[model samples]
Target: MTFAATVLTLYPEMFPGPLGVSLAGRALSEGAWSLDTVQIRDFATDRHRTVDDTPAGGGAGMVLKPDILAAAIDHAREKQPAAPVLAMTPRGAPITQARIRELAAGPGVTLLCGRFEGFDERIFAGREVEEVSLADIVLSGGEPAALAILDACIRLLPGVMGAASSGIEESFEEGLLEYPHYTRPPEWEGRTIPEVLRSGDHAKIAAWRKQRSEDDTRLRRPDLWERRGGARAQSASGARHEDRDQGQ
Candidate 1:
């Protein structure tokens, strides 16, 4: 089955351009995935198709009206009933590679991109709504965050990527950063690829990669390493979890 994504936004044209040019584009072209944009403006009741309003309390910018956004969300739900509706916001859980993997395993997803200042708080108080964030930083709107999540999720879908192990070996897959990679020209500008990589020994190459990953994670993202008791222990525990789950 094709993985689907429904995006609710004010500017519908901004998408399927950047999104249509990358791996997500390839997935769409190959029928591995599909994306649908629901314009909130279309659901507006006013003659001018207005979707935003001044905040309930005094505020610096206009907030999106819940009625218009709710209508847009309802339209998206009708299109993809099984998809989870997600609202992109700064206050939500941080998006991680592990979370992307989990999302990829689902039927599909619907993204609500709030514009102007933000959405009315009532939108989030609903029973089925979920809010997700890309990072700690704020953005002009949620469109970019929606695209980011869509790209990550599409790559993990079956047949979208060239190899299943490719996504698994990427950064954060094993709770460690990815190892460095070198290509072509054995010697370039007096620099050479690591000797272990050129040796043609698979076992040695695997060990080198593992060690480099550990070093990279320890040096760059020590926080991740610390949470898992360093790289080796984390890898071992992850393997055990997989083994136990598989045996069940």
Candidate 2:
């Protein structure tokens, strides 16, 4: 099934931006997925096509009008009934790779791009939209984030990637960051590729990769390690082994 993505944003031209290049662009051209952009302002009732208004009760910035956004969402949904409507905002739950995989496996997704101060609170509740955040950091607008999200999903579509294992072996697929990779010249600036990788024994190579994955995750992303119970879950013997390996 082709993964269809509909983006509701004030800036429709910004899309298929980066998505129209690289692996995502190839997938789009191959019909592995599709992109549809909806102009939120198109749903406005006024002559000025206003889609935002001053925040209720007083705020520094304007809030996206609920009625206009609701109309745009409803219009998008009419065409993609099975797709989930997701609103991108800083206040939303942080998006995960698992969620991206889920969306890629589905029929499609509808992304709501917030602007001005952000979407009015009522739009979420009234429209039953799911809120997703790219990270803790905020952006000038949601178009960039929406583009990133769609690119992620498109790459996971079947046959989009050259090798099926390319997606499976990468970071976050197994709850740990992927192991470091090296290619020839074999030696770069006096830094040689790990000898085990050149030994031509798949078993040893796999073990080294797994060890590096664990060590890197432990040091660089302790939060992900903790989430995987890497601290408490690792056996006492395993820790001793790791110490010995590191000391080598």
Candidate 3:
């Protein structure tokens, strides 16, 4: 089945921008996935195409009009029924690799790219929308974040990537960061590829990569290492280290 993705945004042209250039683009062209954009402003009921309004009580930035946003979401649903709706917001759950993998395995997604200060709380309350944030920091708008999310999902679709192992060994896939990769010249400016990788013994190479992935994760992303049941993984990695030493 061709995965279907619909994006609702004030700036519809911004879409299929970066997504049209890489693996996402290739998948899109190959019918592995499809994309369509809905202009939120098109749902406005005013001459000026106003989609936002002043804050209810007192706030510096304007809020997206609830009615207008609801209409846009409804329109998106018409085209891609059953697709889960996600609103890009700074005050949402951070987007994670697991979430991307889940979405990639599903039919598709309907993304609502929020702008201005944000949508009226009613938009979320009245609709079954999942709030997703790219990071802890804020952005000028949700479009960029949405693009990133789509790109991530697109790359995970079957056959989109050249190597299946590429997906399996990435950071967060095994509760550890990926080991360093080296290529070409075998020698750089005073640097060279690790000897084990050059040794051509698959077992030893795998063991080296495993230990590096564990150590790097523990050092660079202690937060992830801790969250993903790090102790068990560390123990497993330690066992392997011992086995490698015994074989040596």
Candidate 4:
């Protein structure tokens, strides 16, 4: 099935920006997935197409008008009823690989990009919108976040990647950071591709990768390591004696 991603934003031109190049772009051209954009201003009924107004309680920036956004939501749903609507805002829950996989496995998503201050709280109560954040840091607007999300989803679409198992081996799939990778010159600037990867022994390579993933995660993202029940899980399975470090 072709995945469909619909983004509703003030800046429609920003879309398919990064998503228009590389794997996502290629898949988009090939129809592995589709990108549709809705300009929020188009839903405004006034001459100026004003979609935002001063904050209700008197804040620094304007809040997206509930009625205007509501209209946009209704319009988007009319076109794709079942797809979940996501509002990109810093106040939203963090985006996760698991969530991205779920979206990639489904029909697609309707991303609502917020600007200025953010959506009027009433909009959330009135619409079944799921708010999501790309990261902790703030951006000028949600278009960048939407683009990142679409790119992540698009790359996971079937046939978009050359290797089917590639998706499964990536970081966060097993709650571990991805292992280090090496390629090309085999030796570069005095550094060599890990000898095990070059040993032509698939078993050793797999063991090496698993260990690397465990070690890397423990060293870098101790949060992810522990969250995945790192020590407990590892203990449950018992250490892979074969995974013992070997310069060989």
Q: Give the best candidate by lDDT.
A: 2
Q: How do all models score by TM-score?
A: 0.89, 0.92, 0.90, 0.90
Candidate 4, which segments miss by more than 4 Å at Cα? 230-248
Q: What tens-digit string does per-residue lDDT give for candidate 2 at 101-129?
A: 99999999999999879988988789869
- lDDT, residue 68, candidate 1: 85
**Model 2 weakest 10-residue run by lDDT:** 228-237
Q: Which candidate is the best by TM-score?
A: 2
Let me know the TM-score candidate 3 reaches against the reference structure: 0.90
Report the CA-based lDDT of candidate 1 relative to the real structure. 0.86
Candidate 1 vs candidate 3, TM-score winner: 3
Residues 65-116 of candidate 3: C-alpha lDDT, one tens digit per residue: 9899999999988887878999999999999898998899889999999888
Compose the digit string of candidate 1's lDDT tens values, residues 1-248. Answer: 88988888987887876768767788799888887888889999989998998888796999999888888888888888888898889988888888788789988999999777888889877536788889998999999999889988988999877887998888988888999999999999999999999999999999999999989888998898897575578789899999999995
- Whole-model lDDT for model 2 versus the true structure? 0.91
